[model samples]
Target: MRFLRNALLALAACAFAARPAMAQEILRDTESEALLQDMAAPIVKAAGFQPGAIDIVLLNDPSINAFVAGGQAIYIHSGLIETADNANEVQGVIAHEMGHITGGHVIRSSEGMADASRISILSLLLGAVAVAAGSAEAGMGAIMAGQRAALGKFLAFTRVQESSADAAGAKFLSDAGISGRGSIAFFDKLMGEEIRHGISQDDDEQFVRTHPMTGDRMSRLRDVYSKDPAWNTPVDPQLQSRFVLMKAKLEGYLATPEATLRDYPLSRDDEAALYARAYAYHKDARMDQAIAETDALLSREPDNPYFLELKGQVLLESGRPDEALESLRRANELTRNSPLIAAIFGHALIATEDPAHYDEARQVLRAAVARDRDNPFAWYQLGVVYAAQGDEPRARLASAEQQILSREYARALMSARAAESALPKDTPDWLRAQDIRMQAEAELERSRDRR
Candidate 1:
């Protein structure tokens, strides 16, 4: 379970499967994800981490929360995303998580997790610590779950790490062209709210009880925010859009399409709200409505990557593969190195009538897999494409890899057997996975000769 969950994390939050075909559900929409990319760019560049590998995901629980688990991914609860009013407040949170990763908080702390069937529970426990160490913790139960004595005596140690992250995060913001107030003001907001909300709800953590949010600290932070060198740079425009898109997506997911449509900007002029309602319509399978909404949106923002991607998706679902391809191709061009776009393109190629398009589909999926080795959709699609290409050996290999990603090792063995039948008798990659595959010819020959 740790192995599987960790795989998704390493892949930058592609998904997690609690059941077959229902695997890791992407929590946020493409727009918010793109916004997170914008928020992540400067901090990652400053920290020298791989850009695009670190994404911010919103969990659905309403309790104010944000966390970073699985090394490179940041998880923010939808509650937190909706709770923050402006971009800098959110960037402040991003900076804190960046602090944790930059300071080696994850590697130093997570070296101790053990494997068991209860690995999911353990990973949850350990993952919380890693997230806290990463310099951001919100959501319900984070503080208590992490600081619990049963968990460890680690929070005291983690507090030092947190302080270091706070200092480093401030520096990261200064270097990344954002203000310290993005960081300071965010803490201030939490502190400010806690004063009004006051005291734990039945579900709230006890750790927050002892970790007081003092007026003096907030005042000092405000003073620092005013004098901080980083405040001159405004929040990125893209981040603001993502903020709206995330709220809109979460709102759509939690509520009704009627609610979304009813609230959609009264004007035909509001593209952002229009796009949101289109997604809501798509979710509702009101295909004509969704297509109409997207068409109007595309008319206004022909080059907008998010709108183009949505239009392509609507086209595909509406059974217009040819049109989907054109729109998807444009979307792909607008976003560099996006696995989601590649996967959509792969689907487009495979659906087309051209026989040679299978290879094109394979290549696009391969690119997606290369970008995120853990994206099961890319690996699964590649396996299908390779099989269609009559490259049973490669298809088998892809199948096995996908199985590994999805925790279906038994089926992986089946794929390996079919693949090995078509390949040269031996290869190193095949040999490494030999124990897990069906018995092959050389092994059979060795058994017969020994007998």
Candidate 2:
């Protein structure tokens, strides 16, 4: 599991090649990502997007929310996953966010904001004129009224977008042949939370809110969904099973050990419970218990790559790098060298501190990074391999790759320039270094202008 918090501002920055500073930790796990992809594939395809064109990122946050922030990606908070009862609920969420993407809502949001700003400015000007005429009380009232009008206008615009997204989501679910029951159910849960938190549910509250009231959303969705043929379709058992395990795994990773153990006690012997306790034990530094839990999971499904990955991660972090290699290697093979898992496996090979493993680490990491250039961690590991082999120029190039992704433009510029000066002219590595140098310089210039 990779938690990109500080070094990576947002995975979207790398994944989408867009630099939007978001102060949220990104959670990267192979199993969760694979399952999310599987769950979202049909919905995404139904929305006319090609496979793998959209990314679903998990944020290590406790807020029950999902959003599309200027990319063909859905950012789902861990809390939302934890709150969901099944994978279908998440698919419903994904379909809604996809609606925003297809509708160009993120790009169009600026228009709404700009329109509201104009109304406010016009109101302020009229208020100033009234004040100049010696009616200060009337001017104050006008200004307040203008502010309210601007807010109402913006809120109404957003409400329309939300309704559009809701309709689009329902249509996508219908097109994908997935039941909308989960969509209505999830909204029902949101309504329950609103009531539990003492949020006003009256019609007066709807105008001030960005989204339509949960009750209203659910009512409309239920009407449309009940008429759809997929409404009574059964949930995919395998998908639901995976969702349970994923949710449990997330809870164990995010919650305190005490809470994890309390919720998933040792008495529970199910796969989900074992998965949760494995992470819980690992977090608490109970290596023996963690290994035991992982072993139990592997025993149930001997070829399960995720269980092996967990075991390898536990062993590697617990200073058992030599022991981690076999499990990680097998996990990497089973996953067909998934970039994230392969990176971890390469790290394990390097952690052995044996020269014999360095060559393999270099090969594995090089391929991993080649497949996923956005992975700064893989580039860092590859750099270590190059440095170990006394290849300073390539080492610098790798560092440049990592530094650029981490938004260290000045350091990236220096590293890329150093690599470029030393490497053979017009070679692939040289070209890459030059590209990094130019990109870094442009970013730095943009930064200076912004400042």
Candidate 3:
């Protein structure tokens, strides 16, 4: 409910508020994530990267922006998705970011980040020392200076990369057989905003601050869309429908219940409307209404895995884990064992507290982790089950795996070392222990160097 998690891989773990306060927080929603992946698949492949290789992260911020960070991952704001009229708009944004990745823009930027990190550490340390000495002005100045320098280095990209990404993104959409009209439309929207508000030297919006607009940029995009055959193509109806449903769900979860009702009134009779209302009801603890809405969806699409997953989640979260089991089990079966769903299923099984079900829970969690190594929740749950079964060494190793995936390097190293000492040498578990210990140690060294 709160979030899952990597060393750096875990840096992007389930939605967490970035320390030192960089952004609102990250979020993890399986349904929304599935929609994003569906839209991004063709675009990522067109950009010459395996779709699975690029992680799509949903940020909780309500700002219209998208960017690549920490390598290979695309972070898109929930506001952008909610604001988009259709799947193509979101996909266009994704393609553009992918263009940056394929263009090696992020890699080029990392060189500056390395230097910036050092400067940031030094400045922060000096600031802390000054503050300890009661020199408030000096401390604040040092902190501000460091932040400005780091930001300057980080944002030193030219308009050239932006333009090139625009062109490359359009090509990717065209090659992938998706219309470039959405991309053009989005740029047009941004251009209109720029015209109305006028450019600010210090615009607060990340997108506006980073992406400079120019007549040439606008003309280039228009040219790309105007001449392309797919320019006028409509988004796939199924994809558009899914996008609508996804947006509705986000509104239900992220917005106030009254706001959700106003936006998705009961007067509206659609699958998406019902789905949104279900989440709203669930959020408000009106279980009867929530269950009714979920059942309505189930009546229409009995085998819809997402609906079933939602039903299971609602029941589990509502303290009816026993009742949740059937829905979750069926959902997992229907979806071919989605790790996210399985993780939840495993949770339900563990919550039942039936000793008879412990092995089954372990089995389910093991399968889930095997399929998705980045799922910290699954790893953590697996650790719990191991501990419950009196498998101390294995439990510690599982804990280490979860910690490592969570970027808790020092804690992970201690657990891994303990597991290694307790477990047999050269065995698979021992070998994994060795691997985690080494990785944790390396990360610890890097962390020290940064300080």
Best by TM-score: 2
What overall lDDT goes with each candidate model? 0.65, 0.88, 0.80
Give lDDT tens digits, candidate 1, residues 277-305. Answer: 88788989988888888788778878978
TM-scores of the candidates in the order shown: 0.71, 0.94, 0.80
lDDT-better candidate, 1 vs 2:
2
Q: Indicate the worst ten consecutive residues by lDDT in candidate 2.
A: 1-10
RMSD of 3: 8.4
What's the CA error at residue 56 for candidate 2, in Å? 0.6
Candidate 3 TM-score to native: 0.80
Clashes of each: 10, 0, 3
Inter-residue clash pairs, candidate 2: none
Provide the lowest-lDDT 10-residue window in model 1.
12-21
Per-residue alpha-carbon lDDT of model 3 for 279-349, expressed as tens digits? 99999999888888899999999988889988988988889999999999999998778899899999999
